[model samples]
Target: MKTIATASMGVTVALSLVGTAPAFAVGGSFHCDRPPIMEVMEQVDGSSALQSIVNQYLVRWEARNATEQCQAYADGRPYDISCMNGRRDWPAILASVPKDYFGRSNESLAAAVRDEKRKGNGLREAMAYCRSVGAIK
Candidate 1:
């Protein structure tokens, strides 16, 4: 019975993943017009170079807005959807992962292989810069 339950739970998780909308990861084939907010946030926040000098509350607010803006861009919604929280006048920054080399069919094999790793870092770098600045600012 325990083994059956474990197998059923695994199946349930797999089904849930299949039913969800496609989310592009770093190495995924899906072209992400916008980065996954949390993934980028983790990268940015994990950076040892960044230090917090601003008020804690304000910092948290900035982080929240950054996350919302990224999510909005990913969902094809207005980038300022999270502006209701505060800082409505600010423009949104949508960080994108460039797939030019891997996305095109005309690329050389070497280029495709070389760009795979860079493509992953592209999202992380862009998102980290945009999102981390807000939190650290």
Candidate 2:
């Protein structure tokens, strides 16, 4: 009976793991559009670089409102969308998109990468700056 119980417990644990989403799936592709927000998180500062990128994207999206921002994400170019939490008064867009969408803008992320080099700091430092400015977390 003890052996049977242990086997059941193991099976339960395995099932739990299988039920959850894969970490990579949550992160999605590493395109400029879907930049990795975790890579730039500075826990000490309580800032978010990804949030900054989202804000910039909203600005441009509001101006165009034609999936232009999404296209920019696809094209892998520097584009601004910053506009107060990246919604630009369009809360519905924020609600409809996935939670990961906020941090996946290419323009701010590319800027972060370039800033990393210009400041002569490594990835961690650059990311910290991005977070401090509320760019990505």
TM-score: which candidate is best?
1
Residue-level lDDT of model 1, residues 1-137, one tens digit each, is 11223443343334222312332332222222332332222322211111110111122334455565656556556554222222222222212222232223322434543443233323233345444434212
Q: Report the lDDT of model 1 for residue 22.
A: 32
Task: Report the C-alpha lDDT of model 2 over 95-131, residue by residue, as the tens digit.
Answer: 5333643544445455653443244312234333333
Task: After superposing candidate 2 on the true structure, give the runs of residues whose Cα lies further than 4 Å from its correct spot.
Answer: 1-46, 65-87, 96-98, 101-137
Poorly placed runs, candidate 1 (over 4 Å): 1-54, 81-137
